[model samples]
Target: MNNAWTDFLARQGTLPARTAEGATVAVPLTQLGLIRSRGEDSAPFLHNLLSNDINKLAADAAELNSFNTPKGRMLASLLIWREADGHLLALSADILPALLKKLSMYVLRSKVKLSDASAELALAGVAGPRTAELLAAAGLPVPAAPRRHAPAGEGRVIRLGDETFIVALPPDALPAAFEALAAAGAQPAGTDAWMLATIRAGLPLVTAATQEAFVAQMLNYELIGGVSFQKGCYPGQEIVARTQYLGKVKKRMFRVHIDAAEAPAPGADLYAPAFEEQSVGQLVNVAAAPQGGFEALAVLRTSSREAGKVHVGAPDGPALRFLDLPYALP
Candidate 1:
């Protein structure tokens, strides 16, 4: 366990496990890890590799991006931010080592230096309707919109969505910062609660199980600003662009609720009667809903989603009902 996290939980007591409308939860994001790319060539090096236009990333901004295979399958989805001296990419910790190695392979003559910065930096999720107010009361500058960040004491505060923000700071500063946040009305909740919020927000994270499963569009990456259509070629640029311009995207990620006893794991296949024995969709992420059962994001063939009922595990398994996503699908 992280010492700062342990200390925070010890001081704040156990927070309410359920997600409520006006409550603010302090979530320990231990499952996610960070990678730092530093040097004069950092921007161009990443620009040549990721789906988004990294070259245009502003100093105070962050963006959703992806690393894809040459065939246009997504290998990893990332939340990239700019720092004073480097760039930070946050993704599933389970894939961090392999992703770090994969990214290093393309360095060639670039001056960029990649390192796992997870140990050096401590991250926490602060979310709810009171998120901005609580952070502002703690003397942190609150970002006004998604993808924007502001300095907060010795760390930084990044807005992930309307009422969601991430706090990134040095390990030494975590305890005091968290203490202030708790005192300012942020409840201490487990990471599962945070993941639930992420799913409800329609954010899809790439995990080890789902690596190289779909192209950017199939996951609605472009709809959510994860892809830059105007940017120059990267590894899977041709395929991504072709899908955007010439080919029609048949599969897309959707928000849905499953009335199952257990939350389905990422990459679990979803079945529809129309598809018979073949899988028509795959789970991207799932979290126990505060209301009941489970909520998840899945990428499914458009025809299947429209023509037949979806189920978890098999055709006769627990049924899944589609929920409206925060944004519209193109």
Candidate 2:
């Protein structure tokens, strides 16, 4: 990361207040780190390792993919997109260093080369009602649909949703680009708000604390296009495929509202009445809601979710209020 860009964001004051509905804000996504893969073997190398089908990735699009353990547990969840030279992956920053090292261990004779690109590239999230207008005014391409990316100034403009866009550009270009959008009525939203938007969108972000705690299906990877049933064998592919084909996926991630006084952290145990003393769920991602509680994602037994209330932290702790996910689940 660039110290200049980091310094500029440090002066942006406190975290912006936001709700599940989101706001018209421009945010520096400091939580995510970028990784670059360039070489003839980049696609094939990644195709053999990740949950998503890399072979089918389109030039103008991005896909939710994961690096999983041999047991089908996720080590890292990434948003993979294309670039002129090769591919770029955006994942939780806390896990990037270790993930990069682990991936390198597998690059025996592969032509692909991986490097941390966070210093050179920066990610700025433009969200809310004015997202499109602000992008166009900033001289960025406004993608027509979600999951599609378009080349812009020095990086790429990715449209995540109707009200959300992420611009990945050169670190040197971020300050100017951000200023132009803010001048056009985009509030300087901090990572807190950006995180809320992600939780509400039902996008599961696997962080360091929650790594390998659940399988790909438990996080609803399959439901949200993070997994490809048709893709060839990856680490733990057999278990993942068996879970799918045998119809044995019982636990799935769900969105919820927790009215606790303090915010919950990832990997926190959840309980349900029917499950008794057993932990029926675990918090996956959490962000403070603009309201007096937290908006979060949790992986829970489908049976527990339907039985009754699920509480966070303890069996008798604060109850979690369920929320609707942007997409439907089967």
In order of listing, the candidates' clash counts read 0, 0
For candidate 1, lDDT tens digit of each residue in 1-330? 356655665775655556665568888777899999999999999999999999999999999999999999999999999988779999999899999999999988999899999877889898888898888887777998899999877678999999889999877787777778889998877776787788778889999999999999988989888999999999999999999999999999999988887778889998988777789889998877777888889999999888759888887888889998988887
Model 1 local distance difference test score: 0.87
Which pairs clash in the backbone of model 1?
none
Per-candidate TM equals: 0.95, 0.96
lDDT (Cα atoms) of all candidates against the true structure: 0.87, 0.87
Best by TM-score: 2
Candidate 2 lDDT over residue span 220-290, tens digit each: 88888899998799997988899988867789999999998888888999999887889997999888887
The pairs that clash in candidate 2 are none
Worst 10 residues of 2 by lDDT: 14-23
Q: RMSDs, each prediction?
A: 1.8, 1.5
